[model samples]
Target: MTASLSYAHGTSATPLLGETIGDNLRRTVEAHGDREALVVRSQGYRATWRELWQATTDVARGLIASGVKRGDRVGVWSPNRHEWVVLQYAAARAGAILVNINPAYRTTELDYALRKCGVGVLFLARGFRQANYVAMLAEVRPNLPDLRLALTFEDDWAALLDAGRGVDEAVLAERERSLQFDDPVNIQYTSGTTGFPKGATLSHHNILNNGYFTGEALGYGPDDRVCIPVPFYHCFGMVLGNLACTTHGATMVIPGEAFDPIAVLETVQAERCTSLYGVPTMFIAELDHPRFAEFDVSSLRTGIMAGSPCPVEIMRRVISQMHMREVTIVYGMTETSPGSTQSARTDSIERRVSTVGRVEPHVEVKVVDPATGAVVPRGTSGELCTRGYSVMLGYWDDEAATKAAIDAAGWMHTGDLATMDAESYVNIVGRIKDTIIRGGENISPREVEEFLHTHPAVSEAQVIGVPSEKYGEEVMAWIRVRAGATVTPEELTSFCAGKIATYKIPRHWKLVDEFPMTVTGKVQKYRMRELSTAELGLGKAAQIKMA
Candidate 1:
């Protein structure tokens, strides 16, 4: 029998939606006029589809009145709130490119995004937690000649909307009519692990259809209420959570401004939310909260656990304890509208936990030899690549980087190493660039990390390659022990004895309160390497090579 190659494409009878975001929102409102559309617990806001349309249109008009034009960039820097949602649709309706500014960014990062994108108008919250956005903007304003205006959600938000009263609806309608489905509508910065961040530019068609299909994969409907605790700046929240809910006419429930375990549990119980969204760590926090049993989460039937590969044990616990029998694992990056594959509601627990499912609707995914770009045979590990309508137009204003990422055939070369089963399920092994070469043997840190997760005292684990004089590279683990649990490195290494290969076992260990991560919850392994090398005085070892 011929072995299956690592290539799969998704097909469905349902045609892709060609309309723009505004057009889709109008159709949804027409169908579910009186149905609940949005519920913001932090702001005590609730709106039906009709009311949401009105508010969205008002904000769209507000953008036009503020002199935003087609192709102009408008930046939104805030946490998850009603205003952020309003601005997202508003920018789409006004034909402006919505630039998502990470709320956690300081002056340097914020300044770079604003100037790079040439943002004409900026919408921001006064402050989020400890970062005072207003002060940071003030510090960076002088260098941003392209920033025509700045509007704060605290005081200027109302006035900005009121400014629309003077603008006619016809003007907004004309702008919306001019928008093509392929027109760029959003720009999101990828996590700059190695260098400065690059903006991933997405179109109306790129995101809207992806969102619709994501909801379809989850079996979402008008009756489903989705609790979204993830940050809107990431595609997981905006495209998957908000856009998914809106495209399906489902109600969007915001637990809080930021992720709060207590708030998530309370909101889920109070709203009887049918679905929930979070990364694996977020779910872990909710499951391990001291008051975990206080709230009833019986309504949760499905959701997504992604951003990183979820431990199999945690997946089982979430399914059994959280009542999320249909919860799936999604896999992708910001460049691919953030999801190339997702498990189905009917998939077996093993399939859902072990793989990221098959290719998503209208998307083609393949694992190829990293150097040769040839499709790999089943069970052979290679770099995963995806091509589809969902792929971003390119990195914003950086054609060189864009060309380097998306090849001539239009496949986005994801630097993730993965394997495909004969059944077509893809298992992400680790990052191709993250593979550790110890004593000339290849080791996947994810493999060791997953094994560490099985340890009773280990709550979280991040394994990285540290420089070694003799071996050239050695495995080091950073662990977060379970609260009230005592563990030492000696105990952990002893547990690994006779269980796994000697080289795969971590040679050094450090206990950490938390792993260094991006705002979107992705671990920074490069940072870990730098810190570990410096702390361990491995400078000379880093320069050595295996003889």
Candidate 2:
């Protein structure tokens, strides 16, 4: 839908749809000057709104001085540091599109993303662990034809700030003159599993409005301190972790490096963090840590969990042991500003645990049969389609792919298979491309996979839930053994005995050498399915004698 189209679903009380993100930030800064805006715990840095406004202005001036113009692309390739937040605001202030490049990217991956986005300036960390970002940039320099400036976080930050001296008024006026609410603010690339990554162009309004809605949904306020361990490169970090807190005048605690459960605990205790945002794997790791019981995490109130389905046991621990007010399960992709459906705090435990919850305010969702392109009846599985203000402005320079995803009615057809229950809560069953049709019964691999993960010995599991000639498709399990542990195929089968149906049980099991993964670490089930089908001939059928 066009930016002027107001009503999407629950967006009735939202502010004017046409306002720009920078304008909103400017207003927030003006209103909450003395309030602390960000807390960089690693650097021992805290900035009030007034200080953050000035720093953002200074960095915007520095970017302009470095030849970054309006509509140009600037890449921020760093971990969860103050600079990452500064660069985002600075780029927004200058009307430059910020390209989020994951800090975990290596030379090859970085080259691909930088070249694809045609980035003009890169703000990078000098070095972290084995990643020498400066050295990697030097390697990519030859191929990055549009790249003009390399600003390192360590040695060049002071010099860049110095260059902005005596230019605040000029830069602020320029920012006001050039900024527009509809301008593209960020180009977030999706982790491509099937093909090359697509850069989803998010408008200034798209992200800002989403942040505001998220804050409202979670009941955030000025007194709340949010712990943000998710990387800023991801939408979870940018929209929910950073912008959500900033919009509400809340304090954000950034740890600056990879997540350590102990470090996270310490930060939460030290900062008195009241909320947290993380993926399922992150929480699983934190709960599984040996010293988890020693930490006092009583301060946390609420948070959002995504990336995968959270188990019921883990949810219990989060509420019983950690004492979090609520753990909301959110589902979306890079295309929809990364939030479409969210579990409300008041939802029943069955709804919260079994479904991903209802569509967010101002978002319209439908389940349509992929082949027929017709809306399905409630509770019938189909491709989940979404249309909303947060829907992205198409993939960068990939019109064909964009057209394939978004239709003429503005509905973006998410590749996920799902169903809406009587309460309108959406339950994601599986990826449309990953469905397993065994014996004419369409099976969701996620269901079987989640059930199998409950097994104690199974640290990680993937169910290619692939095609069989006799049954049409068969369930195959590829498992990763826990360290210094062993489980045979029969034992794993027995583990699923009472938990899942007989057909859902994997007919064949293989201990994988290593899982093929995407850049963001999601297991590539398509590849695993291919390997399974190739290794175990699916065409053959076994004759069984019925008792």
lDDT of 2 at 508: 89
Q: What would the per-residue lDDT of candidate 1 be over residues 1-547, giving only the tens digit for each residue?
A: 2457888889889899999999999999999999999999989999999999999899888889999999999999999999999889989999999999998899989999999989989999999999999999999999999998999988898898899988999998888888899999999999867677999999999999989999999999999999999999999999999999999999999998999899999999999999999888888889888899998999999999989889888899889999999998889899999899999989999999889999999999999998788998999999999999999999999999999999999999999999999888999998876888898899989899889999999988889999988888999999999888999999999999998899999999999988887766777888999999999988833543212
Clashing residue pairs in candidate 1 (N, C-alpha, C atoms within 3 angstroms) = none
Q: How well does candidate 2 score on lDDT at residue 521?
A: 41
Off by over 4 Å in 2: 1-8, 16-18, 166-168, 456-460, 465-473, 478-487, 510-521, 527-547
Collision count for each candidate, in order: 0, 5
For model 2, what is the alpha-carbon lDDT of residue 546?
Answer: 14
Worst 10 residues of 2 by lDDT: 1-10
What does candidate 2's lDDT look like per residue over 1-547, in tens digits? 3322211255456663466666777787888889888988888899998899889888888887787788999998887789889889888988899999887788988898889989999888897778888888898799999998888888898888888774656766766677777789999988766566789999988888788778877888888888888778888888987888888888888865766677788888888888877766567667777788888899998888777777666676676777675768888988998888888877776777788988888889888878878787777787899998889999988899899989999999988988887667889988876777777577778888778778877766778846666676779888876556789999999888877888899998988645775433456776776677667766433332111
What C-alpha lDDT do the candidate models reach, one value each? 0.92, 0.80
TM-score per candidate, chains pooled: 0.98, 0.91
Question: Of the candidates shown, which would achieve the greatest lDDT relative to the real structure?
Answer: 1
